[model samples]
Target: MRVIEVEHFEAWRAAARELLRDGVPAGDVDFCSPSTQKSLFGDESDDGGRALAAREAAARQRRGGVTVPPDFLKRARMVACHRDEHRWNLLYRVLWRLTTAEPNLLHVAFDDDVRRFDLMAKSVGRDAHKAQAFVRFRRIETEDGEQFVAWHRPDHRILRLVGPFFSRRFKSMRWTILTPDESASWDGAALTYGPGAPASAAPSADDLDEMWRSYYRSIFNPARIKLAMMRREMPVRYWAALPETQIIPEILAEAPARVAAMLKYGASGTRAVSAAEFLPEARDLESLARAAAGCRGCELCERATQTVFGRGPSTARLVLVGEQPGDQEDRHGEPFIGPAGEVLNHALVTAGLARDEVYLTNAVKHFHWEPRGKQRLHKKPPSRAISACRPWLEAEMTAVAPRVLVCLGVTAAQAVLGRDTRALKTRGVPFASEWCERTIITWHPAASLRARTDEERRRIARELAEHLRVAACA
Candidate 1:
């Protein structure tokens, strides 16, 4: 066997290329580390000299360079970072197959060699990502200046891959990240790499470590705790380096009592008087809208982009009231301009009424939503939030004083005519309200937009148009 030993990935690649160029079959070669035991069958005393001579000869006889897929190089680089001693041999075997048996060997998804390389690459990539996320720098006072340092342990040789991330993130500060396999230091102007250091060299605690622990404790919502998911994202092995992990047990121990308290009081248990102070004294629509912008009547206002008040003429003959502002309405600072708004517009045209002739507003002025990944999904406002915002809606009604009051959904119906109106049962029937000459109830345009089938959507749209047509003629 032609015994070839290499120290690193680049050296292995150089030696493999020479062997491939000389048409040496993989079975005839013994790929190994430089310090590994020699092959028992044959011992070549001048193996290193013969290998160098072969490489020089192959370089002279190079007609054209060997070629592989572009993605293969990237995959090879990631796999090369793995600490496995057999990686060189595995990669060389794959390279041989790519050149001879199958030109598109990497494309074979189930191929044993391809799967093994993929797993190694994936492991290295995951380790790099976790290292970037979990590394916590602690401030240390030194005679030179205050410097930040962190100690981390990664599963792969990924210091070179993840070093640039820290450099870019802390470009203005001096910091050092030391791992068992490698170490990196940044001095604000330049980054330098050095040999690996022991974990004992890192600081065990910092002055602000307690503050960080407190912040973590404050943000840890016991009600939303998912131990399995937490462990999956932040493995227990990394707990030693993370300062927050020290208090995790304490938090977990108290979680049951905290959760009981939360359940008893509800999420928004704080009771404050209605935000009457934020209301405008002016009886005009524009002034009311401006004042509503600053109102903090309920917790909903804290999260919504802005308060969306009523819009249209102060003397409109018809006034329409719906639930609350949706995601798009919150962003645009206007009511009724989302998918539900589109449905309303189409229904208005079909009912022979122009949208501009009617005043459009929501019973609650602020949007209430919860985040789902990148989206802000609408959540129904609680009864207290609706009650808190009632004064603003009542103010708009009193200012506009439309001939016909159209309640577009259950919340609006309950807000105007009291909860006993039973919006679903009273829809399409005209009634008299003390606030208006005629009051009509109908399904909110959002209800039609959420229909599970096309037929159901059309039916709901027709029902909405009929109710609007009656209110317009009233």
Candidate 2:
């Protein structure tokens, strides 16, 4: 067996990719790490060789083409975050099967390999949650400005995996989160990773500690305390670093008295459901339209004047989904009636398709916009909005039951195809999606309108018409 060892996820990915490219069977390779038996190879798995392997693997990834489902690679990346002794080997075995004999292997939930992979990924996901939840940052004064710092020791090598979360949550501020295995720091502009740090590197207290402790004490509901559940979610290992945990003993001792005092007051938990939950029992196009007008699924509904539903014959076989409504569509409560609509109309004529012969809709019925002077300029909907409005889109698809589904932009494609798909790179190619037999994605008419030059606009318009023609023929 050829010996290969990896210290991290990227290293394993690189080496596994190289091995796969060489058409090496999974059984012919031995994947281990320093904590395991790297020395058993008598220095063959040394630093120099591992470094070279990582470089080559990166080059291969850049060259593209890994045929496993997008979800497989996503899960594999998460699984690699785990420090399990056999994850590397298991990943390679599953990948080999996915590429060769069992292309639909991930669909088999009870299969041993898939189950193990799912379990490992779940553990990594939990570790990621712990890292995101429990790491408490203490404020410190620096020469540049105030910088927040925190220290944590995650159960897995999840520092790299969860760094992006910290960056997004604290985009405007500078902060540093230190762990035993790695450290991540976010300047106001960018996020950077450095070497591991000692717990002593983090400050034990900050000026806001007292306020934070006070707030924690105020919110601590002894009546709702479940020691077992709390310990499981907020593990004891993390308690030493959490300042609020220092007062838990005192709080627990006063539970009975607090419960008695709380009996004098009352709190209740009841909430209204969103408009999607208000779907009529009949579950048809007319009902969906009426229900969507009051959709409180997301904040976008608060501003959009009305929910713009699809327009076409129910018997239409070819359905087109756009990103969202433009200014004109939002005002008129229609799918396509703006400059983009004109472009789509022109493309339809060029491709020999009639507007009434096909269903026209959008991924999001609500228009998300920003103020640009006197006009409401269209903005890309948030991922949360995309997710919130997805059920409505699916309901439309079910009601229409179109034989052919066409996505007109990246956002719409992401909603229809799995969110992780590289929609741009492979536009005009047919995909098999749950909604239809032949799913095709192409340039949005809005994108063509935004082209910088006339030549580019013409080229994109031609491309859009060609894709429409392909969809019609399909």
Among all candidates shown, the one with the greatest TM-score? 2
* Candidate 2 wrong stretches, greater than 4 Å: 34-65, 266-474
Task: List model 2 lDDT by residue over 1-474, tens digit each.
Answer: 998877667677777777787789999998887654332123446777776666775766664566779898888989988888888899999999998789999999999999999999999988997887688899998898788999999988788799987786577778999988778889977877777789999999976677556645654556567788679867999988888888889889988898776455333322222346645576688777766765657667656756788877778999999989988787656788788998999999999998878989998888999999969999999888887788888888989999899999999999878788788887998878888879999999998889999999999999999999999999
Taking all chains together, the TM-score of candidate 2 against the true structure is 0.53
Poorest lDDT segment (10 consecutive residues) of candidate 1 = 36-45
Clashing pairs in 1: none
lDDT of 2 at 295: 64
User: Which RMSD values do the candidates have, in order?
Assistant: 17.4, 17.3
lDDT of 1 by residue, 179-213 (tens): 88678899998887776778798999987688668
Per-model CA lDDT versus the true structure: 0.82, 0.82
Model 2 residue 288 distance off true place after TM-score fit, in angstroms: 36
> Candidate 2's error at 303, in angstroms?
31
Badly placed stretches (over 4 Å) of model 1 are: 34-65, 260-474
